[model samples]
Target: MISKWNILTRRKMRGVYIIAVFTTILLGLASRKFSHLLIPFIANNAGDFIWAMMVYFGFRFLFVHKGLLFAILLSFLFSFGIEFSQFYQADWMNQIRETLLGALILGKGFLTVDLIRYTAGILIAAVFDKRYSS
Candidate 1:
């Protein structure tokens, strides 16, 4: 029942989201790798902020049909949930955290500041998406 234009728009949006996710990931990695060259505040916080932006883009890619508010809420829930999950110190979880991939995904430890970084990142992403996606 969808029009051809709607289908094309969805595909285009998905592609945009995919690119945003990868770009954010690269920036996050670069922030960590090149932290010594940057300001101390950005060096410490950019990775987390970029990580949250990547999460928002990823949800947008997956839920391309959903409204911007839906993506915003879902991204916030997901990012915050992952941050909170770090408080669980079960042996199995710790084992997973030990791996490089798991460490990147789940993070090594919970920091209160990460929540602020995530909130800012998500809000900024939503603002950009709202402004540019139309």
Candidate 2:
């Protein structure tokens, strides 16, 4: 049987994976370096969107040919998991969130509104991925 791994390893997908990684890095850097120049609204909201985009790319990397719906579902779940993880505030976990990389990945706190932003991000990514992959 044709497997999901086969779909992910196709030659064409390599470029998409590379692009996703590049875009994720660029967004991370922008969120860190350029955030100060953005207006407060955009600055505050951008991280949630970018995090979702990164999760979408991760889903794409894993499932490749599984298509947009799967990617959206997986990305939303992963994003929600990370956001929800913030509620567990132990010393080790708090220390992890204090570090720069950990802060980027785990986040320091949960925002109820982040769920909306994550859904928006995943949907926007699905539209973009469908348009491109078709």
Candidate 3:
């Protein structure tokens, strides 16, 4: 069943997943290095959301269906993963996350609240999956 998705997406999905993996890694690094300079306002968080959507669509539209669960899970994990990174960070990232934008994306210490946001992102991707499969 899912292999059908693999066949349809094989040409495109690999390119996108590779891109997403690279982008996510780069952004994760940036969050560690320049968190203070980048975070600013609520829009900062929205920007993160946009990135998530980018990843989600990259999967739904281009990637294989069998991989979707892991893709979405990785995206969500990326969110919290970056957050935990602050503990190891020097200070700049944490400072930036303190600002409205920083907090929106980088966030503070772990909170249960993050699960809600992750779920919302996943659901949005799932909706895209169900609606666009035709």
Candidate 4:
């Protein structure tokens, strides 16, 4: 399927990647600040997943120097960093982290599921990247 679209030719799809990354960062900032506006468990974690995927696909689209292993490592770093960020930053953000689904998605203080989900997300993005993007 990727054989059709010349996604990275003179067209310069860097803008797409840039938009994805920017949007991810923007959403994170929004979640941190406006967490009170979100529904208890669902919104934050769902946002987390989407954010992770956005960053993954954003980087995957932008750079040409990563593999599955690298992507997984990136995912772990991103997830772990975001989780750790919950400990000592963004008061409202921390509140959102207190929910059940939030714990499951953001993770329970520290656990493996978060990492696994990160890897899964990154793997999915990378597969599509290899398959669909030029």
Candidate 5:
């Protein structure tokens, strides 16, 4: 029973989410590639923060009809799950972690501080989404 306007709006929102995800990914990679140019704190935390933001945008893209809170909760769960998964050290998993693509997706190590970074990132992205997505 979707109307034409509703479908168009959903497509537009999905497009915005896709752009957000892509931009966050670029920023995350640039943060790592040019860490020396950034302040020490940003250099240390930007990748994790941006990674979390990208996760939020990705979830938003997939669940375009979901509420903001749903996206926020799901993103936090997914980000935290990935962070915690780093605790497992099986040889097969370690091999995947060693690859460039795998290393980026599955971080090499777990840091408690990364949880804070993720929280901050998700909160910030939610705030922005709430304020602007209306």
Candidate 6:
């Protein structure tokens, strides 16, 4: 029998997953390319939004039956976990942060304001997902 986790693996949501992937990439590139044009608030926190969406999409793509609130919660928990991880500052962790990908994923520093950005991103993602799913 098919399970809830198997829902996302089916072809029905392929388009949703593809769109999420593209949107995530576009947001990431746009954040970098237009950083100069954006205000400090947007420029500094845009990545948090993208990160939240990435996590949201990831959960929707895996646990397709899960609800919007679930996605939002999972994304926030994960983003917060990663942001909090920045406080470790161990030698190995710092070494990882030195790399481009690592820095992008783990972040160089912790900012409390980032939590808001992550929430906004997940909420936006949930809205979009609800719209598209219907």
Candidate 3 similarity to native, TM-score: 0.45
Clashing pairs in 5: none
- Between prediction 5 and prediction 6, the one with superior TM-score is 5
Q: Candidate 4: misplaced stretches above 4 Å?
A: 1-11, 61-109, 116-134
Q: Encode model 3's per-residue lDDT on 35-106: one tens digit a residue.
A: 578656432343344446555655544446455576677667776576456565557777787797677556
Give the candidates in order of TM-score, highest first.
5, 1, 2, 6, 4, 3
The runs of at least 3 residues in candidate 2 whose Cα sits more than 4 Å from the true structure, single-residue gaps closed, are 1-9
- For model 4, how does the per-residue alpha-carbon lDDT over 1-134 read when each residue is reduced to its tens digit? 44435544514555655665677667756766687888976454545555677668565555534554575567668766876655564667657678865653554455345555555556665676566655
**TM-score result, candidate 5:** 0.97
Quote each prediction's TM-score. Answer: 0.97, 0.87, 0.45, 0.48, 0.97, 0.83
- Largest lDDT belongs to which candidate? 5
Candidate 2 local lDDT, 24-121, one digit each (tens): 76886798689999998878888888778878877887777676788888888899999999999999999999999899889899999999988888
Query: Residue 133 in model 3: shift from native, Å?
Result: 2.8
The digit string of per-residue lDDT tens for model 5 on 1-134 reads 99999999999999999999999999999999999999999999999999999999999999999999999999989989889999999999999999999899889889899999999999999988888998
Candidate 4, overall lDDT? 0.60
Question: Cα-based RMSD of the predictions, in order?
Answer: 0.8, 2.8, 7.9, 8.0, 0.7, 2.9
lDDT of each: 0.94, 0.82, 0.58, 0.60, 0.95, 0.82
Model 2 lDDT at residue 16: 90
lDDT of 3 at 126: 58
Rank candidates, lDDT, best first.
5, 1, 2, 6, 4, 3
Q: What global local distance difference test value does model 3 have?
A: 0.58
TM-score of 2: 0.87
Candidate 6: C-alpha lDDT: 0.82
lDDT of 2 at 128: 79
Query: How many backbone collisions does model 5 have?
Result: 0
